[model samples]
Target chain A: MRAPIQRYRNILDFALSSLLRRKGRNLALICVYTLVIFVIASLIFFVQALKREARELLIQAPDMVVQRMVAGRHDPIPTIQAEAIRAIRGVEAVQPRLWGYYYDPVFGGNLTVMAASDQELAVDSVWVGRGVARSMRVNEGDLISLRGYGGQPILFAVQKILPEASELVSSDLVLMSEKDVRALFNFPEGLATDLAVTAGNPRELATIAAKIVELFPDTRPIMKTEILRTYEAIFDWRGGLMVVVLGSAILAFIIFAWDKATGLSAEERKEIGILKSIGWESSDVLLLKFWEGAVVSLTAFLSGVLLAYVHVFFFSASLFEHALKGWSVLFPRYRLVPALDAYQLTVLFFLTVLPYTAATLVPIWRAATVDPDAAMRS
Target chain B: MASSPMRKSTLCLSLIGVQAALFLVMLLHANAQKDRAIHQRLSSGILVRRLGLTDLCLFTEARYTRHPAMADRHAAFQDHPMGLDHFPSGSLLAPPTFPSPHARTHPAVPEHP
Candidate 1:
């Protein structure tokens, strides 16, 4: 065992020297290989992190959101529907949600106005999101006025600015009292945007959602699971689209690796022959070449993954952030919580490291098996 | 031959060291971002009540409300029909007492406000 270990160490040393001998070519190969891995790893990390963030935040969301559809368009749900939903079996609570979009001409953007139940606001006061506060140049206690449905400017004191930390969800959010929202949007007295339904038993969520549709044919019950699946599909589709876009480059790299592996340079062939002639067994020659491939690939893999982590988590995935985050005028700048999937890393390793290492083996074997004098002459 | 192996091993070790250093830098950056997020959450007011930091929340709110610019704006908007009249004079930071239209009618429905 000690002899074998010592022999492998010598092979590794020789492999390193051999690689250093062709510094320019190997360096170029390592650079390109590392770049390819970096792009793929960054995409995977960005998508997974966004997905994890969505899942974490959505866990606290209501089990089912019941909305009324009129002529295939979302319509305000009547408050009376809440009573019926409340009486349904397995339904824990049914709360009517008041929320709407307010188009601000000044900024040429829409602000999401929602009723806040936790903290009360005076009739003339409202809470603005961090983005809104910044864009409007308004701070706490400042009076910001908005044009209501009646064309009258409704003045509201800025009671508090929603935290910038929650900006991902609240960037364009405005929390106002129900009366303020109703007055601003001119929403009718007994109508709500939708109903947030909670289930007493987690298992009964599906049953309650189905019953909701049955009870109200025109109503749609959107379950949290469906929303999660929708988000997953969206990210997967975008990630797939990017992969397709980078497919040609990836193919080029693979071809380059294949060509290099099969057509070992004359210098490398002579080196192998010299080793074989000097009492080095074919196995030892093969192991030396294997180490060369393994060292280059493993180093590239580690460096690529590290660079990708910094790119996605630290730099906010600049190249793909805009596309994945969707379009908004006042987009919230928030650091995504870094989340890694071991399965994804494993798949990446197999996809990149395995094929390149395997490609080297065939040419190494061909060179190792030949007669030393014939190989050297060639 | 001895020197060649020694030099090669040193080179390989240096390469690995560079990668490890980059990884450490990323870890530190991630930690910084996490700390920033925590600070933002603390100051954002949303978590104040939940975290039992209402005193800090109120103090911050009071400071903002008492600023000269805010006081001036409050006084200027007094003449507007839907303005400072709705706010009780001394209770500028008071919680709303007016029930929303839905809460006014359907008392059974859970009110979020």
Candidate 2:
């Protein structure tokens, strides 16, 4: 019978006071929820960043490359395949590339490869990864000796140290003439690892690769886009595993959140009932509890997101502990650049805030709708 | 009243059971590393046989105690030669059409080229 506006106002006032009265319980719930959401958000953020890096590396590479596989091992294609690939329609240029890893003797394996060409790819005439250059303590034109794939000692004069590139696995990369690669590794004439091809149109990449494969059945043609897809799949599998494990923690937090938000002791219920009998309407009691839920959940979610940002950037999500660092020298140590796309952020907010708020209302509504007289009698 | 209390107890127990089940699932998932390693070794063995390549699938615990690195890190499979039955139908390691000039420097390198 009363005006709806008046009811809303009374509900707001009641809700605020009720929440303030039981601040301790709500605070405890906030702490638990924050910890749970923080972990989940950091993982999601870091995995996404890893995928982006892989995609960028792939996009920056040449259009298509041919790698031969024999007996499940990757074998170098004959340097002769360069001509056949270059002859393909829409192919601009075909360059032979040499790739091999050297056991550093001090640390683990350091990978060094020459991106061979008739002409130099970069202005410096050679490209070396920053990690590789840093590890060897070599500058431009500095000589480093490597035991080639053939186990023969070979020397290379560094052209220029390249920027830190995510595409390479090892610290040492050298780009030079195919002849230089052959000379350094003592590799045979017919064998060169792959042919890096530049093409006229990016869209027609798949068609071009298919044609090359048809011609040379022994070789497999891989496009730049395929490289991106492969890395995406690898990261996706790793992220899927992290999700499976943390999914349990999230469920546990939710059950605890629901219980903490909804549950009220018998004494507290009687007090609320007595207050209702005195003057409070059912609507006022409901509003009071609703405010309590919204305030706690929202505060917790915001804090959790901020904490996750710090965890990802400064702490590197503690990924450094096991797979990413001191344990495996193979894994690089890098900060996660969090990608907060609108959809991702929105989903995170709704899943954290709405459920906990709705959970708070269920118990309160049940208690409020009960007859005020029975509350007094009890 | 008795029925109500019994139902409440049942609900509590059911929640506990769900929690236990979830915990067990997590524990099993975490402990599956040993199983995965064994699977990898067995799969590698099968691949060798299917490819028509002959190699000793030396279990590190059983064989090659003297050279720790070879035993631990390097699996002893490359020593055996590929023959008719062990290698698949398509795998043909053709002898070099022209002698590789680089082959002279590294004699230990395989003769596939």
Candidate 3:
């Protein structure tokens, strides 16, 4: 038992010496490997985190939304539609939601203005998102003015600023009373932007959606699952696009790794041959190669992942943020929540560490199994 | 330099050990973020539900890119690509979200073709 453990330790020691013998070349290989891993890892982390944020925001979303269409364009559904949907069997509750976009001429950005449902805000009071407040240059006590229909100026006091932590969804959001929204948009009293419907059972969402559509032919019922699936598909495909775009870079890195591993320096070959000539078995040499690959690849992988984590969660993935996360001007600046899932790390390992090790092994095996005299002579 | 065997071994071991320690720090950071996210979501959920929040305000270059589910199928194509030209995210976000099956076909059951 002691002999086997000591033998492996000695091999590990020899591997370290061989690696340091050509420190510059090995260091360059490691740096390139680490960079490739870093870029790929950062993209994966940002996309996954953005997906997670979307999913989290949608958790509180209604089971289904009912909107009316006219001439293939979205139109405000009659508030009376909620009463009609409420009578549907198995429907828990239906709410007529009032929400729309308001273009602020002073700021050149659109703000999402919606009426609070469960809680009633003072008709003249509004809750402003951090983005909205910053853009409008208004504070909690300050007043924000908007031009309504036919150039009717509507002014309201800012009651509160939306929390920054929730900026992912709420940025550019403006929450007001139902009456205020109706007045600001000159919306008819009987009309609403859409209907938020909840079902007693999540499984029954489809049945209820179908019933709503059947009751109102012109009405479009959008299930929450469809919304979730849409987001998942979008994010997954976006990540795929990045991967495809980076495919060439990854291929280049793989080729470089293969060449580096295949071309063992004459000095390295002579050292291995000399070791074999002096009572060292082929297995011992092979084990040393394995250790060398493991150390280099593991170091690169660890540093790459660590740097990516910092880049994404801490620094907001500045390198790839534009491609991955982009809204318009005054968009929310929110840091992604960090998560290092085991599955993600495993996939990354396959992407980075495994390829390098596998590339090294074949070449090293060929060199190790050859005649000591031949390897030294060559 | 591959100077002393003991020194080289220590260097190797310490290099790996320091990397592992840094990784552990990152793991802790992720866990902390997760915990904070859960807390924020709790309060944020209540507010969003009360206000009946719709799609996330992720994009704002155009109406189609802003609300994909509600966007008309032809809206993005109608104006050409200029609407989302400033950002590459438009193309990526365009494919899945733009076509509103809800308004047209409304396929109740997912059909695998």
Q: Which one is best on DockQ? A: 3
**Interface RMSD of the predictions, in order shown?**
15.4, 18.6, 11.2
lDDT of 2 by residue, A1-378 (tens): 568765654555555556557778666777888887787777766767566544433354567777776764457788888888888888888866665434343333334454444344533245555555655667887776666555555666676664332212223445666566666667788776667788887877888888887888877776766655655654565566667667897788878887787786676678678878888877777777776676677667666766776677557677423432212222333444444445776799888889888888888888888887776565
Better of 1 and 2 by DockQ: 1
Q: Give lDDT for model 3.
A: 0.78
Question: Which window of 10 residues has the lowest lDDT sum in candidate 3 chain A?
Answer: A322-331
Order the candidates by lDDT, highest first — what do you get?
Answer: 3, 1, 2
Enumerate residue pairs that collide in model 2: A15-A288, A132-A171, B51-B87, B51-B88, B52-B86, B52-B87
DockQ comparisons of all candidates to the true complex? 0.08, 0.02, 0.24
Candidate 2 docks at the CAPRI level of incorrect
Task: List the candidate numbers ranked by DockQ, top first.
Answer: 3, 1, 2
- Tens-digit lDDT string for candidate 3 (B1-113): 76644556567879999999998888887887777888767766876677666576676645655666556555643322334432355566554444332223333423211
lDDT of 3 by residue, A29-78 (tens): 89999998898888878878878877887878888889999998889999
RMSD of 1: 13.9
lDDT of 3 at A377: 96
Model 1 C-alpha lDDT per residue in residues A1-378, reported as the tens digit of each score: 899777777778788888888889889889999999999999998888767655555455567778798876568999899999999999988888887666565653457677877656667788887778877778998988788887677888999997667665566667788888898998999999888888899789988988888889999887767656655665676687779879999999889877876688888888888888999999888788788888888888888999889888778888776555433345566666677777998899998888888889888898899999988999
Q: 1 or 2, which is superior by lDDT?
A: 1
